[model samples]
Target: MSNEDIYLCIIGLCIVSYIPRVAPFLLLGKRQMPHAFELWLKYVPTSVFGALIFCSIFQTDSGVDFSFSNISMLAAIPVLAVAAKTHSLPYSIIVGLAAYWGLQQVM
Candidate 1:
């Protein structure tokens, strides 16, 4: 595509991507969420994290791998422990990455 076309495409993508993110805050900033909804929102992050962790641990290019050799499942043990103990997302992520890297090195 031409340079102008590329520029237009980039700008279009930026607007498309930005709107969904900004629209929520723009629309909801002044409103107070219901207590039940707020309580439900609290679990969203944990649920997403759990889903991601399990997907990474259980799935591979070939198929599911639940054997002892699945390093991610093993690494998750310490990461889960750190997350449970500290309740700090950053710390948990750092420990999880370090554990994954160390396991990769060893196995």
Candidate 2:
């Protein structure tokens, strides 16, 4: 295919994708969701967070190397512990990032 054809196809797909995602929110403004669906939505945050934490912990550049070399992961331990114990996102993030920066400097 020509460059023009590919560009047109991508634009068409993007427009198609945007309609389904945007249309419902635009048309149905703050409508009540079913109780069951609302309850299910409550789990989404934890599930997404768990997935992110799992990916961050298990994934690496070369392979599975859960070492102090990974400053983010190292910082995440204290972050998770403090967040869990205190239930404070702002404090956890601030302390975690500071620890990460400190570790990066040392390494």
Candidate 3:
């Protein structure tokens, strides 16, 4: 593709990506959410996190595996403990990564 064409493509991609992200804040900035909806929204992050962790630990390329050999399931134990005790996302993530890497090295 020509340089001008590539530039236009890049600009178009940026606009497309930016609009969906910015549109929510622009639309909701001045609005007051309902109490019930606000309460439900609070669980969204935890629910999403649980879903992602579930998929990562339980699912594999060959299919679902609940065996002891699953590194993600092994790593999740101490990660959950650290998260529960410290209640810090950053620390939990760091511990989880370290646990996963260590498990990889040992196994």
Which is the leading candidate under lDDT? 3
> What are the per-residue Cα lDDT tens digits for candidate 2 across 36-101?
977997899899999998788667878776776776678788888889899998998888888888
lDDT of 3 by residue, 1-107 (tens): 99999999999999999996996688786876688977997899899989998998889898998998989889999999999899999999999999999999999
TM-scores, one per candidate: 0.60, 0.58, 0.66
Listed per candidate, the RMSD to the true structure in angstroms reads 4.6, 5.5, 4.8
Better of 1 and 2 by TM-score: 1
- Candidate 1 per-residue lDDT over residues 60-91, each given as its tens digit: 88788998789988898998899889999999
**Native-referenced Cα lDDT, model 2:** 0.83
Candidate 2 clashes between residue pairs 3 or more apart in a chain or in different chains: none
Computed on alpha carbons, the lDDT of every model, listed in order, comes to 0.89, 0.83, 0.92
In Å, residue 78's CA in model 2 sits off its true spot by: 0.9
Model 3 global lDDT (CA atoms, 0 to 1): 0.92
Question: Which stretches of model 3 miss by more than 4 angstroms?
Answer: 1-31
Which residue ranges in model 1 land beyond 4 Å of their true spot? Answer: 1-31
